[model samples]
Target chain A: MASRILGRLPLDEDRLAQDMARLAQAPAPQEPYEVFTIGRWVNLNLWNASGDDGDGFFNGHRQVAGRPTRLLGGVPYIGELLTTWFNTELLTMVRARNVVEWSIVPHRDFLESGPAEDFFRVLVFLEDNEHALNSDEDMVFHMRKGEVWFLDSAQIHAGVNISSRSRWSLCLDFKAGAGFSPGDVFARAGDYDPAIRPALVERAPAPADLPDRLRALSAVVSRHNIKDIAFLLGKVHFTEEVPIGASWDWLVEITRASGDPALLDLAERARRFFVHSREVYEEFSFVPA
Target chain B: MASRILGRLPLDEDRLAQDMARLAQAPAPQEPYEVFTIGRWVNLNLWNASGDDGDGFFNGHRQVAGRPTRLLGGVPYIGELLTTWFNTELLTMVRARNVVEWSIVPHRDFLESGPAEDFFRVLVFLEDNEHALNSDEDMVFHMRKGEVWFLDSAQIHAGVNISSRSRWSLCLDFKAGAGFSPGDVFARAGDYDPAIRPALVERAPAPADLPDRLRALSAVVSRHNIKDIAFLLGKVHFTEEVPIGASWDWLVEITRASGDPALLDLAERARRFFVHSREVYEEFSFVPA
Candidate 1:
């Protein structure tokens, strides 16, 4: 699994409703960052190092050097709840809102200049809207109101609001080393169920593991899983920085080792569809000058 | 313009026929560098360094350090013809053949390792067949028999042999600094015509020139040219290593400057289709771990 719901925080719906009522009366927040998101998605900074309302430093590392300042007066209780639940200092808190049928473009949060593992985030849904948070590996979760989710911010992810009304989520950023271990928190919250966890597909599997992995993949190469597997392979190649040629070689070797002719054919088709096709070139051929 | 026919070489069809006959009778050539090409494309190395028949070092730089060793006994005249036409030491020569209905996957050659400008390739069509070479910007050209083309190997390009019969081409690679200039050669060959040259889209445009370029693009943003401009914009973003957020900013500024609502709408749609869409994320998101 590329992402996990670390834990669910126990919270009162009545208190969250009060927070929402106060938030409705508060002034509208500014854009999070210049052109960082698309459509009607907007962010209201609740806490950050700089008290500037426009400072869009949502990553925990950026907030580590300065004292956390509460930017808004309406969401103090939400921040307190997150701080108590995570057992760590909350560096930044943001109320992200997506209007009807709006979406945040898929992106990794701490990618540009920060160490990804140094930051983690929690999303406390404020509205029960038809919205889904999707990871790069195609894993999606429909977060519900009063439900706290420890989101893996390191993965490429996005949010889409499909309901008629706007969707709001209180996003909290926490420094990684501040006595906040997500695994331990999940265990404590009783959400660390291995039975529900998806299979972990490595980015660059060892040559020895290729055959077994391919066999497993072959067994589940239906319409439902093929797209997910394809997305995973693409994410792996990108994250691993593997060259297309080398990646194709691995696919070929894995296909041969699978000893499933259908899988071999599927692999070839996938290479043609996802790799050799013009659409692939247009989308992925980013060779920096 | 993405591609152009540089010049036509004067050669007897009977002589080319004879060469093709001899090539057909010669021992089958080994595959070109592993996984560089796809389908039934094969290379019969006529001249290369290392004197190894399997050595697939066809790039111009690799040939500079060693003497050009003629690999086969037959078709020495073909090499002589290329030597005289290019007016430089021909480092590597290979008879590239693509079987009927075969296609080379769209790809850029010498893109990963070498400076693209350090090498230039010439393709002499040995057999007239229905074939077209496509570039990243959607430019396509068909080579005629006895015609010589100075191929721009730096850009992403591909070849498709659509004819029912095998297509043969004599490929020559020349070192860039060995008193070999493509412009000078094309001028000397009387094939340099400014009237026929297509528009030049710079890989990296200066910041000052961006506004004028965007205006020019605006003037031509018809339904027909939108896709090409979109592709060019994508190519620019990738080649310039511009972040998505920054690219969107540019698009927004350009859209406003263009003063064209249609163009602005097109830009927004392009963003959704190319950036926020799941298909784009699935194909293009290669994050180096």
Candidate 2:
């Protein structure tokens, strides 16, 4: 499936409490400086390359010294739950992300991670955050606590947590065996719940003259607001009827109208970096000057 | 008398067309650099100190050499209209403002404009813009073409033009005589139409925990989005059930949460400037560094 709910994990309050306590004490490895984030979005790794608890940066399992996945020293509850509820041998990387009053800009993942069939991604919400939302290219959705979603990260997507409380979720990346299918993995892992369904968000239709309306931003676009405008445009896709790439197009138009060469150049580069191609550790800043 | 519609001007399409043509060719004196503006909000003067059309900056009539208002060299149509419709002897300053996809941040005006009764402010819409809105401390409203509004600029207020089309309005300031009232000026000027009533906006009540929700911005506040956040906060007061000053309080909280000393300092200064005291030509920038 491109992006759909896989199953629901059995809610274990005791285990969840323990995991929450452990995560609260865990030190965030880094403050991500990438274009995809706009707030304090932190990540804690439970399993990844080097097996170092401090190594929270994303490194594909194949690119590191460690041949396969290894459980980090800390976060025993997450490790136990993963190993018990899923086939840990097939897992490549597992991270617990915490977002509080933050947003992840619209982006696609795994551009260079080989064939799409070789990769499998799953996101599991750890708590009920009414104010959180996740948007794929097609639709905006809300995932409840204990929901296991098979996320097609290869597609354009974004996330937002607008609440004062934490929106904690687990991101797991798996490597499929030769000619692997989701059913085979589910049978082996015994984690599938066929009865569970995803909850989708309903949004009002975007105005017909949205492009013309959006061009109005050009009159106000400036260095101080380049990123905010980008974020706002990115959000319009999920909230309105516009396509994900439409935001970048609007950005280009807005910056060009600004009559500022630097902003114009930055908008063009941002369009490329965000929708076209982005390398590991490559960051884009609106005010590079 | 606080913030209400004074009357409706007779719609003269020919004069409006001619004015529009002239305004299109007229050079904008300056792009306003103040806490109140966020886009290309331009003002052209027809009457002011020095009687120079090029002198578009705002200097209260009393502050300049010309005790009363003086017609500028150019823009004879605007000067003629003001002279014919109102008592020019009592007028202090007259300006034509054009806003396209721009917004004036929520702010209180006439903080030092002497006694409230002595100063009379009127705004006349030159065209119909569906996306335009004006908000006072109490409510948001829309003014149609040829409508004349008695604006109490002393109260907290803001303006927004979300359309790509120009939102042009005439700002007329008058220095009232002793024991003055809006009735006395209208009787003297022959500009009042008693039948017109202001169309007030209907808004839902603000959420109970809006302050808590606003504080969430602190988690994501940064130099790149400080102004956007401030503007967003400013707009919220107009759109939601929050007081005008609440935006500043939220700004202060958001900046303090950012842990950025520069942003924090700017927010405090902005609070003081926009709502409290502002000297002539004083400007505020979100990203001064």
Candidate 3:
């Protein structure tokens, strides 16, 4: 009985369902949030928030020190019966995250040099919207979601919005968190080979608890060079170093999205009970859920 | 909405839990009949007396001819809670039929074959003595279950079991069913050429309810010198056929496994409304589940 708790967000099923139906009938999305339907995407829940809104919700990503940043919100969204059903039926709790209006690419008024670079441009549909994300592959699906085509962020990919539909999805990402791949930031930063090191498989059993694809991915990420700091992370990375803007709420969100709240909490409790790693929630750079 | 009853069996949740735990600890089976375990089996609710039981279930193949067979009682066994959780979480209702007892080689006697024709043996472990299975092979994953290699059925290609410990998993033998490719049956029959024939996607819109894989297969099945009987399957083959077996009761078991009686009743109504096509039911074979 090893288990831990992470974050929780309320889900709104009706709104999600309505959005799903609307998006279903809407045409394929395009360059400037044009079309709204076609392809496969169904609603699971809804949350209260929008782009740059103050109700503690976010819609867009920001660039800091040449790095992209995510806004804060407890990762869990409300009204989704699937995760609960999964836990109750399977007896295995999962980590998960929440999404509100985070767009893959900002629907600029057409003349903004097609959005920024260093950022991704996906080429496929994001749940509801049927536009090819210009290499902007942001979503990841777990076993509970048919387990195919779900994108893992660490992988090199991008997308572009070729359709004209509002691009919105309550995206959640999940994975096990442990001091495995994200080695002790305390360890000299350049000491470990960013690409060839092993994951926290022993330290962060999170990958162990996750689905095979993610688990295999953890291995792949471990072997691949970090390339850039913002893109590479491990459960242990947070244990060693402090990064600006990382929030406990963000940790909760990532874990929540992993579909296992229990493990997220476990990471926190592990630091508290064993490592005496007493740091505020928002201090750590990242938490692998 | 479109739905159907899977089946009702002696669904003892507590007993099932206890059985799962006990079986996880059980050793390799000594005999083939031990794998069958009785008291548990294919739930009649999901399927009806119809067609042949393709080797999808792996343990054996049952293709009844002339007369319809009696549908049995039970729930779809996914080898263990681990698998059940993965499947219930990933594919929602996708099943994994682990190899256990079958016509060619019974349980522990697997060693007699010296080596299996394929690497991924459809062997099952005792989870409180329940059965488990897996069929589709869209991707392959390599990882761990408490430090051991974990197998993913999504990727096609066979595997060799070179472990000293028992590997209990749902055996899923993917024989392209009544839908497409004419399967080993047709290829072996030499009635069609695998390379010459265009794949299923090249065909027309298949039965709406069937998964794309199965729909393609349905197209293949129809191409058989068996078109008349195949189309009589109408939407039935697509809707009525369960991953493991095809029977009216299979409908019931799926509903029951959902643990929602309302859904259960939904399936039951379908059974009554569209009485079993006796001629067709008689033709269906019981696959290993």
Give the candidate number with the greatest lDDT.
2
Q: Give the alpha carbon lDDT tens digit for every residue of A81-154 in model 3.
A: 33331212211111112121111211111122122222221111224432223221122121111111223333
lDDT of each: 0.48, 0.68, 0.24
Winning candidate number (DockQ): 2
- Per-residue lDDT tens digits for candidate 2, residues A70-95, read 33435566666676777666666777
| Each model's DockQ score | 0.01, 0.02, 0.01
Label model 3 with its docking quality class: incorrect
Model 2: CA > 4 A from native:
A31-33, A61-74, A184-189, B1-228, B231-289
Task: Score residue B163 of candidate 3 by CA lDDT.
Answer: 16
Better of 2 and 3 by lDDT: 2
Error of 1 at B185 (Å): 5.3
> What's the interface RMS deviation of candidate 1?
26.3
i-RMSD per candidate, Å: 26.3, 18.2, 26.2
All candidates' TM-scores? 0.34, 0.51, 0.17
What's the true lDDT of residue A40 in model 3? 18
